[model samples]
Every structure is written in C-alpha cells, then in structure tokens.
Target chain A: NAGVIQTPRHKVTGKGQEATLWCEPISGHSAVFWYRQTIVQGLEFLTYFRNQAPIDDSGMPKERFSAQMPNQSHSTLKIQSTQPQDSAVYLCASTISAEQFFGPGTRLTVL
Target chain B: AQSVTQPDARVTVSEGASLQLRCKYSYSGTPYLFWYVQYQRQGLQLLLKYYSGDPVVQGVNGFEAEFSKSDSSFHLRKASVHWSDSAVYFCAASRTGGYKVVFGSGTRLLVSP
Candidate 1:
C-alpha cells in the first residue's frame, strides 16, 4: 500500500489568510484522524472521522478550525482567518484497527 | 478525560547502550497503547502497539514495549541503540474500539556515537 498521502508538504500563509490541508487515507480504511504538533503545545488531537463521519472534534479550535471527510478516501482540514499561532505541523492518519499509519504531514507556517 | 504523558522531553544515549523511554496514561477503561517514532520532518511510524494480548509487544527495529495496567504505564525499551534510532518518540492511548486518540509530549532521543 502507498499509505496515507497529504498534499502541500509545506504551506506559507499570511495572518488572516485561509489554508486548507488535504489527506488521502489508505484504501479501505474506515477511520481518519487529524493532529497538530507544535513545540510549545506538543501534540494535540484536532478531530477524527469514522467511516466518513465526524466522530470527535473536541480538540479543534472551533472558531476557525474545521475538518471534513466527504468520502472514504479523502479528508480536508481548513483554517479560516489563520493566525501565527496556527503555525505547526498538521498530521493526518488512517486506520482500520488500533494502529494508525500517518502521512508525512504539512508544515503550515503563518506569518 | 483521557491523556498520555511522556516525562522526558529529551534523552541522550551512547550507541550500543540500552534505552528506555517512559510513558503513562490516564484512562478509566482498558486502553490500547502505542509507541511511534518520527524521524526529522517525517511522519510518525508505529514502533509497537499493545492491544489485549501479552504485556510485552515487539515492534520494528528491535523496539519493544511493556504494558502495566497497575502502573498505568507503557514504557518502550531497546536492547541496544544505533545512531539511526535517534528520533522523537510518542506514546499514545485510545479507548478500546474508540476513534479518538491521546498523544504524549514526544521524547527526543539522541544517540551519540
């Protein structure tokens, strides 16, 4: 399997701009997850979907952060009015069982 | 609430030395634990996982972890280390059959030759 794929390995956005990150899960995987990593905050769970449905998003910032999985293969995480605090590595993972396979992640740099 | 904790932010070891990275979890139910390794600028790679079987689970590159329900701990161990083993390690936990996962602050391992 080619494993999970994430688009735009790196992204630069000015403050107040919008940014979208994409993830393509492994074939036939039923669960997709999103996480954010920053040196100050460590790792934070943004949200997750099961069978293309959002299951949990308690970790998301709510105001400007949102995620969607419209189909089985792909999921998108969008940040509107992005801030400098949003600068971090956004990770996407896919799984059918306990273990998840992760994508290389998109490094979002907001200036 | 569920959470994971890795007390060590960074660890350094000489090549060929043994290594152990600590992890602790706070969960009410039986949780599935996992250890993942991340090379610089790379994705997280599963080093090992513990579901319901034996307490000790083996993973890639001579990596292994032991789970202790009483201690609420799942610590990773390696018999001997190499420079290639230098990476950030994360400990994660999830409720059984649950979708949400909790990750610990990664432990950065620096293996010196």
Candidate 2:
C-alpha cells in the first residue's frame, strides 16, 4: 500500500501569500490527521477528520489557518498571509486503528 | 486535557550500549501511550504502544516500553544500540474515545559507532 501521500514535497511563499497543502490518505482509512513540526514547537496537532467530517480543530490558529476534507481520499490545509513564523514541516497522517501512517510532509518556507 | 513530557531533549550513547528514554503523561483516566521514531527528513513511525495488559510492551527493532500508572510514566529502552537507531523519538498520549493525540517535545538520540 502507498500509505499516505502529500503533494509538493516543498513549498516556498512570500509573507503575504497564501499556500495550500494536500494529502491523500490510505484507502479505507476512517481517520485523517494534520500536524505541524518545528524545531521549537516540536510536533503540534492541527486538526483531524473522521469519515470526512471534522472531529476537532482546536489546535488550528483562528486567524489564517483552515482545513477541509472534501472527500475520503483527500484533505487540504490552507494558510493565508503566510509569515516566517509559519515555516515548518506540515505532516499528514491516516489511521485505521490507533496507529497512524504519515506522509512525506510538505516543508513550507516563508520569506 | 492530556499532555506528554519527554524530559531529555538529547541523548547520546556508544554503539552496543544500553539506552533508555523517559516519558511521563498527564490525563484523568486510562491513557493510551505510544512511542514514535522519526529519522532525518522522514515521517513518524510507530515503535510500540501501551494500552493495558502487561506493563512492559515489546516493539519493533527490539525496543520495549514499560508503563507505570502510579508514576504516569512510559519509558522506552533497548538492550544494545545500533547506528540505525539514531533518530528523534517522541512520546504521545491520548484518552480513550479521544481522537486527539498530544505529543512530547521529542528526544533526539545519537548513537556513535
């Protein structure tokens, strides 16, 4: 199986620009998760979906961050007016049981 | 709220030496604990997990963890270190019926040959 797949292994955007990262989860998995990893913050939960419906998003920043799982196979995380502070590796994962399989992640850099 | 703490930010050991990484968690009820490893430029991979049953759970690559409810701790250990075992290890915990997983800051292990 391909596990989870993320698009645009790397992304670079300006301070005010917007960026969208995509993820394709394993087939038949019911849960999808998004996490942000940084040297300072470590790994932080951003949001998650079950059966294509959002279960929780408390970790998401209220201002310029949003996530959508339009279908069972895919999900997207969008950041508006990106800033250097937002630079990090955005990871996507899917779970069938308690164990999760992660994608390669998209390394986003804002300059 | 649930949280996990990995006290050591970095650990180094010589090849063929024993190793141990500490993890503690806070939660109201029974907690599901997990150990995950991440090599450079790679995604997180599950090493092992503890739900109940025996306090000591064995995982891949000869790694095992012992969970202590009284101390709220789940520490990972290996008898002998290998160069391939060098990676950033994270401890995570979640309550039953909760989808959210709280992760620790992670402990980076460097094994020298």
Q: Model 2 clash tally? A: 0
Q: State the DockQ, from 0 to 1, for candidate 1.
A: 0.80
lDDT of 2 by residue, A16-98 (tens): 99999999999999999999999988898999999999999988999999999999989999999999999999999998767
Which candidate's DockQ is highest? 1
Candidate 2 residue-wise lDDT at B12: 99
Give the TM-score of each candidate: 0.96, 0.97
iRMS for model 2? 1.4
Fnat, one value per model? 0.77, 0.46
Q: Each prediction's Cα lDDT score? A: 0.94, 0.93
Tell me the TM-score for chain B of model 1: 0.98
Q: Could you tell me how far off, in angstroms, the CA of residue B51 lies in candidate 1 after the best superposition?
A: 1.1
Score residue B63 of candidate 1 by CA lDDT: 94
Q: Show how many residue pairs clash in every candidate, following the order shown.
A: 0, 0
Error of 2 at A42 (Å): 1.0
**For candidate 1, what is the DockQ-based docking class?**
high
lDDT score at residue A16, model 2, on the 0-100 scale: 95
